[model samples]
Target: MFRFFESLIDPYPGAVPETPPRRLLAFLFHYSRPLLPLLLAMTFFAAMVSVVEVMFFAFMGELVDWLAEAKRERFFADHGGRLLGMAALALVAFPLLVLCKSLVTHQSLFGNYPMRVRWLAHRYLLEQSLPFFQDEFAGRVSQKVMQTALAIRETVVKLMDVFVYVVVYFTGALVLVGRSEPWLMAPLLVWLLGYLVLMRVFVPRLKLISMAQADARAHMTGRIVDSYTNIQTLKLFAHTQAEQAYARGAMDGFMETVHRQMRLVTQLTVSLQTLNSLLLVTMAGFAILSWHQSLISLGAIAVAIGLVMRLRMMSDWILWEVAGLFENLGTLQDGINTIAQAQAVSDSPKAQELSVPQGEIRFDKVTFSYEAGPRGMDDGNHAARQANVFDNLSLTLRPGERVGLVGASGAGKSTLVNLLLRFFDIGDGRILIDGQDIATVTQASLRRHIGMVTQDTSLLHRSIRDNIRYGRPEASEEEIIEAARRAHADTFIRQASDPQGRTGYDAHVGERGVKLSGGQRQRIAIARVLLKDAPILVLDEATSALDSEVEAAIQEQFYALMEGKTVIAIAHRLSTIAMLDRLVVMDQGRIIESGTHQELLELGGTYAGLWQRQSGGFLGLEAAADAAPIGAAEGQTRGEGEASVPDRQRQ
Candidate 1:
């Protein structure tokens, strides 16, 4: 009962697995466990109602025959009182059980199970490793969560309402018809066999169409959401019509499936009607013939007629019920395909909370490769790919050391950071913080000791206060304000007000902070990291969004934030890392040089060449390694500079 009630409002307080449910029946059982008993009890009550209905129809038929009898005077004297008593019993029981069924139907349909399914799906999906979300469409995933729950609810309710009633009512018809005239049983048996055959032929076709429809619907939603997320790109390129056509294509496929499925349904109805008419005519004719021969009474003919007519009504209803069942089942199958996925990274069984005292970071011969295929499994030739990233990389940072990592794109700079965070496990390596291998510590606890500011910031669709406070959710207002001030974000935050009339720190930032400028978003990110105030800090082009003046202004704050902290800063802009304690230069996944800014210049190696190519504070290593300084031409076109060896090289 608790599971059922909980399922209505939220997924039961049990762990949701990260993989697709093993099978549909088992999956439904787990989610619908709480409602099972109630549903069964409801089914029983519905069956009783069907029994009452059959009895009522039988009594009415008998009463009609009794009224039409030639020996009416004799019948009234013999059986009139008992007939009236049975009639009264049927009258009271029919409506009473109907009222009970209605109450149960109301509860089951509106009990909030859909809401719970959505919540559970979202919660479990968010818990999946980052790659999973990256691979799926946000809108499509969202659509499936919604579609699955509704489909399940409709399917369950309809099963009890239509299916349970059909079984009991059909049985009642067979028994009543058999007792009335044994010859009439032949028609019922034939119709039953025909119905089973019809389902076997049509149900599989409906399931296929339903699956197709679900896929097309999800695709359509994903296309629309993709367009919306990139609305600016469409407007800028004037491609709104093209995107619309793309979405229309998906809709066209959906419409086509619906057309085909509806045609099948039309055929099904025609077939069912044919069978129903035959059953009705055959049974009624047989009953009349038997009665004419005096082999059965007129009451038996009337009862046979009632059962055949009842069967006709039920057969018509069953056509739709079966169609709906397959439709919903297909939807659930589709939803499960997208919603359940295996986790690439998960916490170890014995992982413990990290204790960061001095914040020393060590990379112990760390090596990794980009995944060869889905699930990050290496198919073959994985060693070739592995060699391209890091073979036996080793690095260590002392407490309070500030290290700058300079590298060309794909030079393993960001991969180093990824390894530290354990976003993906290493192929063969250990990253330790304060002597604790990061892999040995719980991800949540390891992350607690480190704060990061990435180049592309993604803020939640929330207020400025909440985004800032995200760094330290429990931080007081004063602390939040202080962090914002330190990040040079207080000025803009105070000046801003959203359309909803929320001003200052309370102002809403639209999705991914679309309402704010790139610089503003970067500052908010900085404020978040500052508020975090972790022992270890990572800055990946952290101030790339700021102008030269703003960057200079915040340089003081950045220094202050780095005080007594172990910092790993990645900068395409060479100037940002000049003041760090040491500079590490990497190329082709190996650290080529490690020294102070001045020492690297004196070495006249790869570091010296990159420094000379530095134009407008950026190291342009990708454009032309030998080209004369292009910074003056394009304000830092990728890695172009003429190196007239510096005086520092001689020093």
Candidate 2:
């Protein structure tokens, strides 16, 4: 029972496979079971309405026979008041029955029932892991959810309506016609066989067409969303014409698919119409022959004709309804595929919560590679290349140790930080915090203890105060203001204004904080980190976006903020980490050197060369003269720096 419920919740378990059409119907039934009572009620009403329609037609046949017999007498009297009353009753009862059926159908199918199902499905989708979003486009996912819900609702309601009516009406009409003159039903049976064959032949094609149309629509929507998201990039690169052409091409493909499906539907309708006309003519000829041979009365002929008409109409209606059901089923099937295919990140079944600790971090033989290489790429070809971001690398940081990491671009700086935060699991080794393996801890609880500020600052479209408070949702207004002051953002928040001259921390930041300047956004991000006040802090070129003047002003406050915290700073600019007690210089994902700024300079290796290149020109002639290498002094004279210099100088 438990396993069945689990399967119901996750219909496509294990890597999502292609679900057969029947599986989609099963999923709908499982989810919509809660509304079964309403569904059954609607079905009952629909059956009753159909029966009433057949009875009304039968009554019309009776009325025609009565009029034929009473040529000179009062028509109502000749038939007696009972017949008149029945006709009158049908006039009132049919409408009442239809009204009741419509009421139930609308409430159950269009109102709360489907909406509740959609709400639950949407909630479950939102609970999916980040990898799901990584693998799918946001707009496409949303479109699938919405369109699937609507398709399911529409298809279910239509299937219910058609199923009930066709069964009840066709069964009743067939019985009546067979009793009146059994030969009349022969044609209908043949028609039913032909109809089944037609569906078998064409339904698969319709399903394929529907699936193709859905894919085209999703592709067009994804393209539009991508273009809008990168509108700035498009304009900057002067690719407007190219983007427009791409969008038009996608739209054209979508329209072509839609038109092809429409053509198929048209062909189906024409074929069905011709078949229906032939059946009508054949049945009429049979009725005429039977009447001429005196095998059936005129009244019986009337009844048979009425029954044949009902059967023909019901057959066409049912066929069309079934076609629509299949098309919608195709759409629903695609949506199910999307949701099922969403890649879920591996998670432990019994993950433990992260306990508060003293923030000691250790990386033991950690190695990571973002991509698996091609089969033929040799080890030496790879080995001489830069190592995997972290190849058999190890590090340890005690509680409250402020360490700085210096490395060139592509030297595993950000990768190290990402590992510490457990964004991605280490490939070969364990990352432990206070001796607890990170993989054992709950991801949410583990991240709550760490705070970060990156070079690219991002803020939500919300009030400045709210953005700051996002770091710690329960923080009081006073606490937020204090954090802002520490990050030097309070002054800017006070000066910030929206239109109409309103100014304060309550001012709204535009989407992704685009309304704010880079410096202002950085300060706000820093304020968020301060507000979080986590035990471990990671600054990955955090202040690099700010100008030198702003950086200098914030560094003093940053030092004060760093007290009693475990800090890891990664920077390319050596000057940023010059004041740290210890500096670790990395090359090709391996730490090649570690020491204080002065100690590294004295070693006169990679660090010394980097320092010389940065400070050599800025210090001017006298400073350069004092620092000239032993053999280069005769060639490089002081105060002759500019006069004797060539057009190009290499550092």
Candidate 3:
């Protein structure tokens, strides 16, 4: 009995060898444990309601028989009063019992159960890592969570009601039929056999249909979400028609699957109804034959017919509920699979908390690669080469030293920054801060000492003040403004206003700060980083998106702000890093040159070649102009010396 109940409740157990299909029941039991008492109360009430319903049916049958036998006055005189009183009490009791059951079921199942399950699932989803969101479409995830909760709730409630009622109706009908005419039991057994055989043939098909429907829905949801998120891109490219066609294709596929499943269900339901009707006819025929042979009384025939009808209704309801249960089980399984796949990252039990420290970074021969292959990769390319983004890269930054990194595109510059931030752990070697290996420290703690401003600045759709304060949540308004002033952001911020005429810092930055210009956004990002005031700073093409005039202005401010801070700046523009204390040139994931600007120029190596190519046009012309002036000035000074005595007399 306990195992049966457990199976009904929890559907999924642990991932163990030889686990059964009933594991879904195990999941329900696990989640429902807290609601066990309420469930028990609901179950008790449900059983009482079922019992009353069966009793009501029996009582009605007896009342009909009593009316039919009204000619026997002596029989009525002996038991008429007792029968009337009992019938009256049953009529009242049955409805009262049903009312109580309804209240209890509504309170326990409809109200509390869904709320608790949703809360638990939502909390669990929230705890998942960043990769989970990356892999799933937001619409699909939202749909799954909401529909799964609703499906579970409906399945549980209906299962409870159907199981209890079926048991009571079947048991009561069987006993009554056996007492009146035992031969009726044989037909009941036949009916049960037919129902089971029909279910065996149709249930698997229903599950398949449901699974296919759910897959289609998820695909449609994903397509819709993708289109909505990239709507601006579609509009910019004038691909509105193409996007609409793609969405139409998804919807058409979904509708086709839904129609196919609905047709199948219709056929199955019609066949089941026909079979039930035939069983009813057969039962009625047998009961009439038994009455004619005097094997059963008229009252017994009435009772038998009532029992058969009740049994038929019970069977139909149970079959339909079971079918729905199978359908819901498939949906629940999909949700569970999503959740299981989402648990990709888990912190080690022995992982240690990182103590805050001064900025001192070291990378010791780090190698890293992203996941590859069709299943692992987001892109659907099975033949693509699985290559490492970085290989055996080693570098060190002493406390308070500012270094610049120059690299071409796909040279692992961003990968290096990501590694330093511990977004992804290295495949080999170790990264350390202040002599402590990064892996040993908590991720939150390790990030606390680092401040970064990347090329693509993403600000929340919020007030400018809030976006600035996001860098340091506890920062005061004055401190934020000060940081803004330092990053040269205050002048533009003061000129800005929202649609409502709220000026300066209170202006709304549209989604991803779209309302602001690229330069303004970059400066705001810089201000955010300045407010953070971390010991280590990483600037990855921080000024690349700005125009030259704005870039020059920000660059001048950046130099002053970078003082006394350890900085790692990655940029493709070599001229920007010309003033750095040291520049490191990287190629194919390795540093090829590291030296001062003048020393690298003297070597005339890759760095020098790049520098000359970038600055040759302007610097060469300026040098020639300055050389001509130096020679003329020298000749003038020599002429003055040769004629100095005569020039003094003339004056």
Model 2 lDDT, full chain set: 0.72
Q: Model 3 off-target regions past 4 Å?
A: 1-30, 68-105, 108-133, 154-161, 297-299, 307-316, 372-385, 459-469, 474-528, 548-564, 615-651
lDDT by residue for model 1 (1-651), tens: 434443443334456444447488766765667667667767888889888878877786677677777485698687769777886776776677876676665554345666656667777777676666666678898999889988887788778767888888888877886876788889899999999989999988999999999988998898889888877679999998899898899889889998999999899989999999988888877888898888887777888888788778878778778878889999989987877665567777898999988989999887665443223366677554423356679999999999999866655677688778877777776788989988788888988889999888889999999999999999999999999998899999999999999999999999889899899999999999999999999999999999888888788998999999999999988899988999998755678789999999999877777788778777776564445222123222111111111210110
Give candidate 3's TM-score.
0.78
- Give the range where candidate 1 is weakest over 10 consecutive residues by summed lDDT: 642-651
Per-model lDDT: 0.79, 0.72, 0.72
Residue 158, model 2: lDDT of: 81
Residue 401 CA error for candidate 3 (Å)? 2.9
Q: Tens-digit lDDT track for model 2 on 1-651? A: 333322323222233122223377687885566567667777888999878777766777677777777765587566778686776767788778876676666633565555555565666665565445656777788878777877787788887777878889878777766776788788777777777877887777888888877877887898888788667679989999999999899899999988888887887888777777777887788778888988776776787777777667766777777877888888888888876553233336577877656878888998765432211233545543433556789888878888888655445667688677765565678888888888788777788888899887879888899999989999999999999998888988998887646578888887678779888899999999899988888888788778777788889878887888888997766778788767887655678788889999999876676677666222232334335342134232211221122211111
Kindly give the number of clashing pairs for every candidate.
3, 0, 16
Which pairs clash in the backbone of model 1?
4-34, 620-639, 621-639
Q: How much is the lDDT of residue 323 in candidate 1?
A: 78
* TM-scores of all predicted structures: 0.88, 0.79, 0.78
Of 1 and 3, the candidate ranking higher by lDDT: 1
Candidate 1 positional error at 572, Å = 0.3
